[model samples]
Target: MSSSSTSPGRDSKARAADAKPPMREALVAAAFQLFLERGYEQTTVDDIVALAGVGRRSFFRYFPSKEDVVFPDHERCLADMTAFLAAGTGDEEPVGRVCDAARLVLGLYAENPAFSVQRYRLTKKVPGLRAYELSVVWRYERALAEYLRARFASRRDGNLRADVIAAAVVAAHNNALRSWLRSDGQGDATAAMDHALGLVQSAFGTAPPPPADERPEDVVVVVSRRGAPLWRVVQEIESTLTRD
Candidate 1:
């Protein structure tokens, strides 16, 4: 026995290895506190990792950069949104399905109102964070557009409709989110989001498909001399058609 296997250092290392999830969360919590206490530009990754009691490598292992820690749940929320869109049946309107997907995003923010509000304020102050937020927003919009395009592929204006609806849904979602965040997360977010989503639904959603047995009414077409009187043409056509 080398004795190292039974050493306290070895036991501590094993415990730390098993606690990766909590450690990652610690890093995130520490980063947010630091960003709040000392402005985002003032806080460094070293400060976060030190407060977290973790190494620089651990920070990188969880978040790619300082900005990522601010929106830590984005990856999980994006995946949830994608899953929601993927599970939709094609029978429903594309716009409605995409709107539902947008709800997943709002749900994520709603789950942590304080964190969301804080991040919102910080993002508005930081150009780099805002740009990163835009990239995330673009990814969400692209996912929605792809789903809509697939659903409407057979239609003539499918691509255009898909693109437009996706943009509209994103716009509506962001509007609701910003409103809630601006108010310090104090309003009925669901209601605000519902009102925003309703606009997109009314504008882009298609009515239910007609019954299978439904048929169009027969058209009465009359071809007569261009100068013929209207009463004469109508009477002559009706009499001729009804004769059979």
Candidate 2:
């Protein structure tokens, strides 16, 4: 055979290799498969690397630990949320902006409903994963709170209001998200999220328009000390904000 005749076969082989999954994706696929086949505890990093045909160093390069692999997209999602909050136009209410940030999270899960449901189930069964997930959730909550604090800094109760609204948004979003996950990712998740956010708006949002037959009370927001823990401030603000 001539050299030109062999060129096509070599090019096809090169293209086939180029089209193969990336190392990170291969590791994720191998890890999940092993975790499902053998219980999470039964699987090890070695097994994952072996299945992926990659070395242990390669696995570590992609994921810090086995638990990290379970929730691979968290860092990306958190960055996206932070960016969205940072890009706020200053025209929207703080609560509304926070609600919009929470929607980013919902959109992330909705993009991969099947994987979200499976990962939710796996996390429940693994204590380490549950703890990791909690820490990730707190990161998201903190991002929103930081943005709100800057928005409300001039107000008397700025810090307190920021923490409270942040917690409330996270709580409402989780409640709606968990309900959808529990149902195996069925139904309209966006609709459920809207309803949950509306409740939050009613409780902590700007005062709604009063009926023509009634008078409107002047709304007042009380500020708390800046040195206190976020959770304490959140509790105090929540109790005060939810009052009829």
Candidate 3:
């Protein structure tokens, strides 16, 4: 007998299992459900596992603990942003890759407003969760910094400038995201991100797209002390402009 025919019930059961909710989502739902029912402190991983209808191994498979269920998609977001930065950095004038990275991080928050809001609120209440969330934010920054350093490390900018650029981009992105989250997603995150990156690019004498067909000479160049960090370089230029 053919497999499906030999085990028709097994086929139906397999379809049902496939149709079952995603493990992470199910865990999130279970945790939040129990949190609503029994409070966050009262809800144990065992409770979540039982409530989620999976074994403790399955729960651990998706999240390290009950609290881990709160930011269910964080790992995936980090992976996605890292992948995007890797792909987009290959053709960079530096700022392009930086902006793409900034945009990628913001896009994660934009991907799910409700979850972002929920996670934000929860992070605010839980110190450990808040630290974990901050670490998560920094992970993206670290990845972007590595990419930026790789892109500019061989250029005249060298590692110091690349490090500063990466740090500036990450800082700019975090500030924009905090502003957006503070407004409860009412602000335009994309616009905030774009505007922030524009400032970063202007500081570096690089534009995101570099005005197609324009000669490289047309691009504004800010000459700095060759060894200065990009931030110090921008600061030096700004201070000079203000001095006169």
Candidate 4:
């Protein structure tokens, strides 16, 4: 008995298929490669799909548009940041907590330095990408502001304070993040971010004091002669209270 033989060409084709990258990753890699070869505007969804060896449907399945491919991980990172903020115990200092949330964003960039730097450079060159990036940043800022608003709900001008501090946190984080990206991801990004965030924490991180009613009552003690005159006793008590 004899068995049928597989052709060498077909065997090579099978191996190539096996070696292909995952669909989503392949799409992203293809999109960036095309973006670099032909400027962002010159590149189209058809080009990306063609390079990725995927159908247009597959490209849209992973990314809504060509711009989304450039910022592939942001949506996931944003979800993580929102979850992190929501998980807070309410015992954390609001400013410090929000600063920590900002770190999550830095962590995302740090995860893939080469890719992040490439994307950063691309964003700098593309006005549309820059606008899209700004919108994404705005979403992050809003998440932080919402968390802060809840934390500061009982404070005077709480909404204003939350919005301001949230903006500050985003500013500080982006400042550090962009610097790191500018450096080609060299040096300690965490240190840079911490220093920036430290400023925010120092400026607004103090845990708000408990409500006036919740504050501990002040205690006063007055010393006087055993047979002190009422007027003198009253004077001493008033002086003690005033001094305190």
C-alpha RMSD in Å of predicted model 4 compared with the true structure: 11.5
Query: Which ten contiguous residues of candidate 1 have the minimum total lDDT?
Result: 1-10
Model 1 segments beyond 4 Å from truth?
1-20, 209-244
Kindly list the per-residue Cα lDDT of model 4 for residues 1-244, writing each as its tens digit: 1123456645543343335448878888888898889889999999988988889987876678888999988877888899899887888888989999999999989999999999999999999999999999999999999999999999999999999999999999999999999999999999999999999888888966888999888888777788988999998788888993
Point out where model 2 deviates above 4 Å: 1-21, 207-244
TM-score of 3: 0.71
**lDDT: which is higher, 2 or 3?**
2
lDDT scores of the candidates, listed in order: 0.87, 0.85, 0.73, 0.88
The sequence of per-residue lDDT tens digits that candidate 1 reaches over residues 118-147 is 999999999999999999999999999999
lDDT (10s digit) by residue, model 3, range 1-244:
2144445566643353345458757878888878767767788898988988888887776566666687666666677677777666276676667677678667878987766776676667778777777787677777777877787767786677767877788788878887888888887889988888878888974644646686464334477668888889888767766664
Error of 2 at 11 (Å): 29
**TM-score, cand. 1 vs. native:** 0.78
For every model shown, the clashing-pair count is: 0, 1, 0, 0
Stretch of 10 with least lDDT, candidate 4:
12-21
Which wins on TM-score, candidate 1 or candidate 2? Answer: 1
At residue 64, give the lDDT of candidate 1: 87
Tens-place lDDT per residue, model 2, 1-244, is: 1133445556653343334438777888888888878878899999999999999987876678888999877777888888888787776777888898999999989998988898888888988888999999999999999999999989999999899888999999999999999999999999999999988888878853566779666575868788889999888878887887
Q: By TM-score, how accurate is candidate 4?
A: 0.77
